[model samples]
Target: MLRDKIINAISEVGFDEYKEISSADIIFADAVFASCKANTCGNYGQNHSCPPLSGDMDTNKQRFLNYDHAIILNKIMFLGEYYEKMESSMTEVFELLDRLRDQLDDEPVMIAGPGGCNLCDECSAKTSEVCRFPDQKRYSMEGSGMDIVTMSRGLGMTYNAGDNKVGFFMMVLY
Candidate 1:
C-alpha cells in the first residue's frame, strides 16, 4: 500500500519512471561529493545546497543513513538536435518531487533533485547571506554526496535510457 501510494504520487506529479528501493540500497560515497568541485557545475559555492555550502561529506553520509526508504524517480526527455533540454528535464523531476512530497506529507521527506535549487530565479547565495526559500530548496543527489550511476547499478536500474534521451533522476528520501 505504501509503495502504491508512492507510485501514485509519482504519477500524480506527471512522472512515469520510478522505482521504490530501500535507502540502504543506495551507495553513498564521500568521493562522489568530492567530485562536485572537480566537475565544477558552477553552483559550487553559489548555493547553500551545493558543495562547500552543502556541508561536510561525513555529515551528509550520516544524514543519508538516517533515512529508511526512498523512491528513485526519473524523467526521460529527447532534446531537439542536442541535449540542451536539461533544464526542462530537471524541472520535470523537481515538479514530480514536489508533488510526491506533498502526497507524503505525513512523513519526513527529503528530495534530492537533478541540480541546484530552483526555488528562485537567482539564488540568494549570490547577493544575500541567507537562502530565500530555505524550506523549499532541494539539493541535488550528486550534491548530497550520492553517486547516482553507481547507486542505480546497484539497484539494477539503467542510467542511460538511450541516445538523444537524457534521463534525470531524483530521490524522495523518507
Candidate 2:
C-alpha cells in the first residue's frame, strides 16, 4: 500500500522523466556545499537553516549510504517567474512527499528536496532553536551538498533548459 502511494505521488507530479541512481551518479557532495558557501544565495549565514550551520556533508552522505534504496523525484516547473514559481513547485513536491509519508506503514522515509525547505515561512533554526518539524522538515539535496543535475543523470533524467527545467530531489524509503 505504501509503495502504491509512492507511485501514486510520483504520477501526480508533472515530471517529464525519471531514472534510478547508481553509485556513479553520486559525487563529492562536500564540493557542492563548498560552492554554496563560497558563492551563492542569501540564507547562508543569517538563517541557521542554511549550510555551515547544517553540519557535515560527508557525515550526512554516510548516513544516506546506510539506507537501502532512494528514489529520485525529478519535478519540473516554471523558472520563468523565478521565486513565485519556485515556491509553487516546492509546494507540489511537499504535498506529494506528505502523501508518501502518510501511506508509509513502517518504512522510514527521508526526503532531500531540490532546494531549501520553505515549509515554514521562517525557519525556527534561526534562533538556534530546535527544528519545528523533526518529523516533517526535509533538507534539500543541494543543502546536503548533493549535485542534483548529475544525480538526475544517473537516474536517466535530463536537466536541459527550455524543454524541461525542473529541480531534482531524493526520497529514500527503508
Candidate 3:
C-alpha cells in the first residue's frame, strides 16, 4: 500500500521517468564524494544538507542503505540552443521536486535531490547557525556521493534527453 501511495504521489508530481530499486542497488562512489570537495556548485560546506555538513561519505551511504526501497525520479528539460536556460531549467526541476516533497510530506520518506536543500532562501549554515528546518532539510544525491549518472544509465533512465535537453534526478527512499 505504501509503495502504491508513493507511486501515485510521484505520478501526481509528473516526473518524466521513474524506476523502483532496492536501496542496496543504489551506487555510491568515492569519486563523487571527491567532486563535492571541489565545490563547483558552491554548497560543499555552505549547506547543511551538503557535504561536510551532511556528514561523511560513510554516513550518507549508511543513511540510504537503512531504507528498504527507493524510487528514482527524473525530469527532463530543454536548454536553449546555447544552453542559456540552464538556471531556469534547474529552477523548474527544483519546483517539481518541492511539489513531490509536499505531496509526500506526511509519509515517512527521505528525499535526495539534484542540489543542496533550498527550503530556506539562505541556509543558516551560511551564518554558522543551526539548520532552521532540520526535519525538512533536503539531501542531495550527488552531494551524498551517489553516482547518479551511472545509476541512471544502469536503470535505463534518461540522464541526457538530447536536443539540448538534460535530466535532473531525485530519489525518494522509504
> How many clashes does each candidate structure show, in the order listed?
0, 2, 0
Query: Per-prediction TM-score, please?
Result: 0.84, 0.74, 0.95
Report lDDT (Cα) of residue 166, candidate 1: 60
**Candidate 2: pairs in clash:** 19-155, 76-166
For each candidate in turn, give its C-alpha RMSD to the true structure in angstroms: 2.3, 3.4, 1.1
**What lDDT tens digits, residue by residue, belong to model 3 across residues 1-174?**
878989999988798999999999999998987888999989988999888898888899999998999999989999999999998988998988888888888888998898899999999989899999897788889888899999999989998999999999999999
lDDT of 2 by residue, 1-174 (tens): 655565665666545554444433455466687777864556564344358766687665664576655667665565554445665666776776666556553555565655566667787766677778766666666676777766666556656546335554655443
lDDT (10s digit) by residue, model 1, range 1-174: 666666667777776467888887777777876778885678877877778787887776766668888888777777645778766766666776677778887756677787777778888886747887777777778887888988777666667777777667788777
Query: Between 1 and 2, whose lDDT is larger?
Result: 1
The regions of model 2 sitting more than 4 angstroms off are: 1-5, 12-14, 22-25, 46-49, 81-84
TM-score for candidate 1: 0.84
The lDDT values for all models are: 0.74, 0.60, 0.91
The TM-score-based order of candidates, best leading, equals 3, 1, 2
Highest lDDT: which candidate? Answer: 3
Worst 10 residues of 1 by lDDT: 74-83
Stretch of 10 with least lDDT, candidate 2: 16-25
> Residue 79's C-alpha lDDT in candidate 1?
60
